[model samples]
Target: MIGPTMTPEILARITAARAARDLSDLARQAVGTTAETISPAERIKRARRMRQMVNAYLDTVVVAEALAGADWSEITEALGRREPDTVEGEYADAVAEWSDAAEAEADAAADVEELDAWYARHREDHDPDLEKPVADLLNRH
Candidate 1:
């Protein structure tokens, strides 16, 4: 995938803005939702899930931005890791797994409903212009 090409300052600003929006949304949801009606256990579970989602989203943004401008060694050093090769391999594997999952979902979609649902869930992650290319690549494998 092509990474963002903006300067670091611009990217930082965008990331910060997105994070602020996400925080605002989360706060709004917390206030508007039936949080008070739910059991304590359910509330805890929901909070944990939200935390995981937010952390994963932020980590993805940070890693992508870092990789766009920094060398692998720099990333490894920042991470205080000794095995850059292992980290790189793990990243490649994760990407491959994600792509395989998407391709499998597409291949298994048998009807319009299934395809529509898949597209709806993944619309934000995909570009309409790349559909043909992605399909072609998936078909070859």
Candidate 2:
């Protein structure tokens, strides 16, 4: 049968992001939906699940890059060449920028129903039958 095909890098990033988001959602639910919903048992379970998901995602990233023979040394060295203090300051600025952008995104994300619909549409559009078995295997937890 014909299978789904995508660039390795794109697939890796999407898989990583989805897994990260799923872990975040579970952690959020576990810690407490609000100020009052925290249950020790639920929190423990959520923490375990989040850790497992994170490890799995990291493993996926490692394997994906290994398969591609991606060498990160050059990238790392280039990034490391910046003065440590300068890097730290830039990192802090980037964090602030990201936070501001995230806050701005709150308004854009106000339409939860529309967002759900959009997600469904995109998921279907990107559906790859070829990777179904592999995806199913990894998602079995």
TM-score for all models, in order of appearance: 0.41, 0.40
Candidate achieving the largest lDDT: 1
lDDT of 2 by residue, 7-78 (tens): 343344345555655675677675665466668886677668778898777655543443344544432344
The parts of candidate 2 lying over 4 Å away from their true place are 1-5, 34-39, 71-141
RMSD to truth, every model: 11.3, 15.5
Q: lDDT (0-100) at residue 27 of candidate 2?
A: 70
lDDT of 1 at 77: 69
lDDT of 1 at 119: 39
Error of 1 at 40 (Å): 1.9
Error of 2 at 16 (Å): 1.1
For model 1, which pairs clash? none
Worst 10 residues of 2 by lDDT: 1-10
